[model samples]
Target: MYKATYFAAALSLALFQSPAVATADEITILAGDLPPMFNADGSGREAEIISTVMERCGHTVSFEIQPFTRHWKTYASGTGDAVATVPVGMPLGGHQSDVYIQYQNGVSFLTDAGNTYGDLAALAGHSVIAFMGASDILPGLKDAASSFKSYKEVADQIGQSRMIFGKRVDAVVGDGMIFAEYNRQLREQSGDLMFDPNQGVTFQAIFEPSSYGMNFRDAQLAEDFNRCFAEADAEGAIEAINSAWAERYRETLGTQYLGH
Candidate 1:
């Protein structure tokens, strides 16, 4: 019966080594309405990457999208599992986690007509608009709130656009992608208005070149995700996702920033 006993031990070892046990854990990802990265529709490139990687590792995954600030608060409160698409160089606060993805260069500036802004210094005397909680990304501008006007809602983009057209604000300052997307939507609603990117007169990158990644509440899960993300990046899956969305954005919006 020695052979039978040996077979039983081998089977037990195999069961213990299987991935199923690890997958029994669930991972909830908290995200914001950051496009091309984390979309409210669950169709962002980062979401796809996370799904592919985590699924292969046998973990069930889900997402909750809130405002940028609220997403961080919820994750920080330890009410959920993790936060995804956090901008590079931003503090994680209580959520000490690993980086899972690195996005390419992104710019922030005003777009008027077909023109784009090339420098932020040009906006020194002018009023600039920004989101409520994005100060960390634009620390200099954030501290100079008195010099520039700020808004707390996403609809502020529309307000700023109108303000620019009406000469109420000197210029709008925010994520280039968000601004482009907002402008495109307005163009659809009102057929006669043209945004000359050429009208984008003043520009500046308050933040340095940065990337984004996922943050986890559990260190073990963060390790697992990092390993999976690296494997996917190596396999060209991440690149494929970015390329697919880039093409789609260009086809639909005629701009790359809108998709991101």
Candidate 2:
């Protein structure tokens, strides 16, 4: 009887000490339709990274691509379980994960323009265009741009690319990859021969890289994501994805660009 009792206690302890398996969950992750980063076809750097991290944590993910600004509204309306590319310290009641990606934002101008913006203040009298919500997210942008000859924020980065390449704007501000992709698109389309798409441009690294994270409505999922993200990051999975995309963009644009 004593032997039997000891065996039962040992078995109970063993069972209690065993690792728990996470129940698989279907996670809907809302993202913006940023090409080469978050695509509508559910293929991009962020898509792959989110999939890798969620699957590692025993969850399946589906991306709902929306406009850059529209995704925030959709997330606020309780449409999805998580949102990606959330800026740091945004006022939202959700569990935020570690920084997953960073966008290199700065001023871009024609290489032969012989002009330089060593600082945001230097752009005092130049016409500039930027992505939507740039003033709200990027500190000092609105203040500096207030002094510009003209400054406009548009939802379509493709337009930004066109304006800058056409010499219609003195400068454009946004992600390097986004601008490069749009420029490549302009080159492919007909009837845009007025401005050279292949014209060399230089990006003035004036702004610090903008870091972003994933926000999850479910606390438990956010916890799992953080843990799994750390694991994947340590394994260099994120870097590999970033590197592959960077190479593809370099080939596509025929120039080196900021890789995510």
Candidate 3:
């Protein structure tokens, strides 16, 4: 009976020590319009991070980009599993769950020169250009949206560059990466126009330092995502992801703006 006991103990150990298998399913991620995070090219840094973690966790993930207001509405309606770039501890209108990603949202100014501004108060009385539905990114500037001397959304980057060249506004305030990337692409196709870092035009300000994470409709999904995210973070995957994008942005800017 010693041999029998030994076999039973081994079996028990196997069962107890084995890692738990995660459920395989497609998870829908809702996100607002943000470049280098969830862009049209599908090369967003956060998108890659989520994809890597979910794949390792035996799940498929997809994203649907919409306006910030609409994204919140859809998530709150309980129709999807999670929304990206959500502020932590955000009171859900109806949805539930606590898992989230960590990041910050801030304002970036693009001007004729590459000058940096420390805060919103610095732009007092200066005309600023921004998109109509970017309140989530620039909460303080929302009130001044109408008072601005100019405003326009060309639905793409080309028109934005044109507007900037035409002096529609003194500067543009929006996602730094988005504006930078778009201008980079524009300068590539046309050498005449370029972003000059030495022009003293670009400035970035952190309106509110907040954590961005995925909000889940169900607690189980949140738990799973959190587990996968933590595992990925421990494995250094998150750092790698950020590094890759940072390098790309630097390269892009170096080539387009710095004229390197």
Candidate 4:
């Protein structure tokens, strides 16, 4: 009788101590403030990608958009659950998912801007505008921008574009797809800005196409995230998201590099 009583108590204690299955919680993604990619104001494609892909995987995502420099601080501290667009081989964090957005970034100019550059050497002589931290990913780009202006956010891209309209600079070097989006927005939304992005501008690709992906703390989460990408691709989510931006990517880097 005493043994039976002890067994019942042990079973009750075991029942009480056992934990419940964890419900997948939301994760915060820290990202650099790159327009059409990591904007906080609902204009970023990567933000949409994170939310969409994570949702498909039964997880939620919140984005913390800040300067490119600030992104590393948040990411390295293990505070942010994930980081968007970590270039391969950066010693910031753990497992990185497969490439989400891949594009060719390079120097480009308006056909009528009268800037002539056939190669990297010729490009070294011209003033150029580029997104922040471009030199880190694209070697020789910063050095080639004789006069360089780099902005840290989406809104700043407008200033970079306006420089072209105002003739402040002869060329801009950055992501081809991002440049196309900026050109589209600056021209359509040019209210008080009054800048025409399509004055026969012809952009040429200078750097090889590059790949980037989300990096996470744990290997399990990263593996799940990669699987989610595969599932998302199968379900047409990735293609849908890229449809708006694929033109520039396809034109510059080809489809193979669209969403690696």
* Candidate 3 residue runs with Cα over 4 Å from true position: 1-24, 93-114, 133-161, 188-203, 251-260
- What's the distance in Å from true for residue 3, model 2? 65
Against the reference, the lDDT scores of all candidates come to: 0.54, 0.74, 0.54, 0.63
lDDT of 2: 0.74
* TM of each candidate vs. truth: 0.64, 0.81, 0.65, 0.71
Which digits, one per residue and each the tens of the lDDT, describe model 3 over residues 131-211? 444543455665655555544433464455455555555666655456666665555673554343323235353444334
Candidate number of the best lDDT = 2
Give the range of the ten consecutive residues with the poorest summed lDDT in model 4: 1-10
- In candidate 2, which residue pairs get closer than 3 Å at backbone N, Cα or C atoms, i.e. clash? none
On a 0 to 1 TM-score scale, where does candidate 4 land against the true structure?
0.71
Ranking by TM-score: 2, 4, 3, 1
Off by over 4 Å in 2: 1-24, 250-260
CA error at residue 185 for candidate 1, angstroms: 3.4
Error of 4 at 136 (Å): 4.7
> Could you give candidate 1's per-residue lDDT for residues 5-28 as a string of tens digits?
212333333222212112336777
Q: Ranking by lDDT, best first?
A: 2, 4, 3, 1
| Highest-scoring model, TM-score | 2
Candidate number that wins on TM-score, 1 or 3: 3
Tell me the lDDT of model 1 at 201.
Answer: 31
